[model samples]
Target chain A: MLTLYSFGPGANSLKPLLALYEKGLEFTPRFVDPTRFEHHEDWFKKINPRGQVPALDHDGHIITESTVICEYLEDAFPEAPRLRPVDPVNIAEMRVWTKWVDEYFCWCVSTIGWERMIGPMARALSDEEFEAKVARIPVPEQRTKWRTARAGFPKDVLAEEMRKIGVSVNRLEMRLAESPWLAGDEFTLADVCNFAIANGMQNGFSDIVNREATPHLVAWIEKINDRPACKTMFAHSKSEFADRGRKVTA
Target chain B: MLTLYSFGPGANSLKPLLALYEKGLEFTPRFVDPTRFEHHEDWFKKINPRGQVPALDHDGHIITESTVICEYLEDAFPEAPRLRPVDPVNIAEMRVWTKWVDEYFCWCVSTIGWERMIGPMARALSDEEFEAKVARIPVPEQRTKWRTARAGFPKDVLAEEMRKIGVSVNRLEMRLAESPWLAGDEFTLADVCNFAIANGMQNGFSDIVNREATPHLVAWIEKINDRPACKTMFAHSKSEFADRGRKVTA
Candidate 1:
């Protein structure tokens, strides 16, 4: 009844993947590996014109954008465990965190991830293969990013990105200190979205994110990792980056 | 009691302001003049730590982010008219457009706007006054943007921004040709969020958004403008840029 087009359980892909698990929803998982540029292929583009992943196909309808997909699941299947809060004020808080991840947190993590991991992977491809792959990307900005990744992101851009990550991490630390979760006492989609990237911060950004520097953030990551649903989501990884996706959570 | 702290009926501010009008809700409007750096003032920052405008205080709970505020209005005031579609698929579509506007469209428009309009305003200030204004901005990125605007945005950056605007406009035109409103037959928040920025494009960036090039978008604008609520919203403008906000619809 449901099929999720995702890139395993990391970054944007992990948001919906974890949400589905937490909601006790069983659906097909169609992995669209970014490493091979499968997301930009014609078949994938047919499903989503923009060719971005973490899209949910319910029956004949299609939904893109990971945060939107999470909200869609909440809207379409109301009987599922509510990842969204019932109180209007709490819901507003949930959304602020979700939007924060989309606009601020995830991009910083992705920029660093692409620079450290994806850049090497892209650079490994043959010149002919690389050019062909870059040409196939549907979004012009994404294509530019891919080329930049392969060539190496500018040092200043990376530095600024790292600085942003520091700011975001510190904010998370401060927020978690005040409340049990990003949106207050209850676990909501805010935690789901933030953890998708925050989990990565603990591992890849150890220098900036650790018990000594960010004890609250570190504790929250552990709390999220201890969940049964999170375990299932991590174990659900089937892509080539399965190890990378499962590493911190495993 | 509902109280909205906004710049005016334009850009991000128009989203909640127009939504309230469409819902037929009466609320107190607190106009925060950005030209005078009121948003960065201590009192405004107490309302929204980010020092961003277009924040809603429902009763006493504070809500920030223009799109999130619009959704908050929908959730908090369910008895009011629904700006969101009842169907899950349609809600997803509405969110996609809203998110696109927030992520892709708004920044480009704002970049151009600041360069053309705010640059002159900033340049007019005395050297000491400009530095003092810049120092008051809480967010580092916003402070950097203000400094950039005063220095004049890079020629290539503005050119690139224009190119992106053209691409976004063309996409809107193509989408409008197929759907009656952005989310389908229903006039949803997608139209509400988009028309806020699109209406400005028609007037300020006529070179790219004329009726000849974007008939469907132009028609959609006229359709939205024809709404009595839109007329009321334009008339609700109280900032220094009131005329600029009301001009397109007038």
Candidate 2:
């Protein structure tokens, strides 16, 4: 049995979850809470030295990196709806789309969503707790340097990221408008990758996903949300997140 | 004949060039001068809408992105030396290494070599030429916002990037120490990727490749430099770059 270590709202974990769901593969999901720093725990570190989530422990061989894990799953289980086309041209298209998800989309979500939204939210906490949380950031020296550098970040940086999000969403809308998916007429891993990032942006940075700026992207998101598998995954994740929140509150 | 649109001294273009050289495939290299922003020109943008280089026009089928281009070449010309492994495990390893090269290594090199080193080099030009070069930055707004936001970027951001280069060199050294190639015991695309980056670093940032800091990496660079394909490609690129530089200087 494959054990998938994941968290509720992380887009990185969503990649593998979507792949598992898309492939209809049975796997055990062990939810991790980054707020609690569970991902950085010693045991989890043993599983993934990088201490990042969405790690697939397949028959004891650990595979990290969301894209690599997703590709591994696609290769290991090729029967379910082919996530990738076998033809070289189609494969090239898929790779470009996948790279876009990682390079452009992921950057927006992480910077805009995490910095503009999550970091401020976290900072609103009690000083002691906030300090503890900050202390727990992996790679403390690097994180400190980044945070310090980020402190001087322009006030409009968030707005600029939002604009890029707008452009990205517009592009996605154009792509999805032409074809049902990011790649083409078919649903593939490209859609899965896009969905994860879109969901992250929608949840964490809703202002960027408004109909005015990104009507097509909003519509595409709604369409994907209608999928039973996607719905199931979201419902499960939401419930799990709420349950975990309640535990912390208690 | 395949048409490869590329700029001199980019790791992305080197992947396809190395593969073509290894396979002895015939292709015409149309060099783009970054100094002139040729890649973003209307003609080149038709080849790659993203306005990035290393775009290959193979019988009218355009392919971009280094890894994807290499994979496409491998598939299209299987008689060529195999770049990817056949087994699932080996493929997984290859994918991870490839992603590492594209994501982490490329980021380090660009942040350190290009942004810090090359940008300053380009900026040290006549006012008209410098302004023209600066105007060509793809995401001017985003770059401005990022630079503003990182106003207090550790005075040592460049130093930090250089340190990462050291770390990268160390990792590569260890890998080469274990076997003649990056992936244990076999020379695959991984070697090509590493060689390209190392070659660029040596040519663009020699300080990072000192014998005291990374003797093994230095040795590995020499070994890769000795390869017939590598030697031929470098000689061709060197003359081309010299000619282009002289034209620009004139």
Candidate 3:
């Protein structure tokens, strides 16, 4: 059986989960908690030295990197469905769009969601609790370095990142308006990647998504949210979020 | 015949040039001067709206993005030697290596070659010459934005980028030490991408690569440099570089 190592509520992990569910593939899911840094443990590092999820272990062959994993699944399970057109020109278009989704869209998710929203949410602590959390870092030098880097980020930087998010969302809305999915009429890997990150963005930061500003994008999100596979992944993820006592928009 | 719109001395442009030359595909080459922002011209934008060079017009179809262009050439000229393997695992491995070469190795090249080297070269200009260059931008606001961005980068940023180059060079050295190429024993698109960028990096920054620091990587570069197709691309690019008063290091 295939095993997927992932953490709940992570955009990176959601891509593979969505792909697997869409294909109706059966797999065992093992969750990693980023809050606990369990991914950095020696056992997990053996699977992925990068210490990032989602990592997939198919039989004995281990594959890491979200884009790489997605490609692998497409190849391994050709009977399931095609995520890209077979023709060279269409494949090229698919690849470029997939790359764009990963690079630009993923960057927006990291900058706006993780850095701006998630980081602040994680750090919402009393002064004593904050000091204790800082003290708990295994390496003192690393703690100091992290603090310095965090302190260097100006408020304007976050604002600029949020603006970039708006620009990307607008671009995505325009793209969705023309085609049902990110890559024309088909629900390709591009849509899977976009769906995962876009879902997180809309849910984590509703302020960024509104009918007035991004009506088309908001509607597209609803369309994807209604899919059976998406609903299943969202329900499972939501249960995990509830278990952790964190509010989940998905 | 295929037509390639390109500017010499760009790492991205070299990918398709090598692919075309290696596959013995006939193509007409048009040089666009980045210094004048000729790629951003309305005429050029119709071919590639991103306003970046190294675009290919194959028959009537237009293709942009170097990686996609190379893959397109491979598919179109399948009778020519296959640049990518057909097997799933091999294809996945090739994709992984290609992505790494594009993302990681290209980062080193952009940081070490363009951002670091090109700025000092650009800054040596007289005030009138610099102003004239800035005025060539079609959009006034874009010109202001470009000027401000260029003025903001410090020398240390380039130095830090060079350090990253050294780290990547070391990793490549280890990878090449085990196999004849970047991916494995076979010479695929991975080798093509690495050769193009490594050639440029060696030309601009010698300290990052040497017999001692990257013995295997140096050997790999020497082997690829000896290829007739690579030699042709290198020689053809010379006049373009000489026109810029910069020595050709392809």
What i-RMS does every model get? 0.6, 1.4, 1.8
* Candidate closer to the true structure by TM-score (higher is better), 1 or 3: 1
Q: Which ten residues in a row have the lowest lDDT in candidate 1 chain A?
A: A241-250
What TM-score against the true chain A does chain A of each candidate get? Answer: 0.96, 0.83, 0.82
Model 3 misplaced regions, further than 4 Å: A116-152, A237-250, B116-145, B148-152, B237-250
Tens-digit lDDT track of model 3 for B1-250: 6998887635778788888888888888888876656776778878887677789998778888888898888777889977777766666667777777766667656654444435555577777877766665564445654564456556786676666677678778888988887666678888887776777445556666877767888888899889898788878763353344245243
Off by over 4 Å in 2: A116-160, A237-250, B115-157, B174-180, B200-206, B238-250
- Tens-digit lDDT track of model 1 for B1-250: 9999998888889999999999999899999987788998999999998899899998899999999999999999999999999999989989999999988898898898888778877898999999998888888999899889999999999999998998899889999999989989999999999998888677788888888989999999999999999998777668676564344334
Per-residue lDDT over B64-157 for candidate 2, one digit per residue giving the tens place of the 0 to 100 score = 9888888789878878778777765566777777777886677677564345434544556666765564465565553452343234335476
Q: Which model is ahead, 1 or 2, in terms of TM-score? A: 1
Residue B52 lDDT in model 1? 93
Winning model by TM-score: 1
| Predicted candidate 2 versus true structure: per-residue lDDT over A1-250, tens digit per residue | 7989997544778888877876888888888876566776778978887677878888888888788788888777778667777777877888888878887778765665456434545655676765665665565443563354335445586667677777777778788667767777677778778888886445445666667766777777788778887877776663354343334324
What DockQ would you assign to candidate 1? 0.87
Candidate 2 docking: what grade? Answer: medium
Query: Would you estimate the TM-scores of all the predictions?
Result: 0.96, 0.84, 0.86
Report the error of model 2 at residue B171, Å.
3.6
Task: Provide the lDDT at A66 for model 1.
Answer: 95
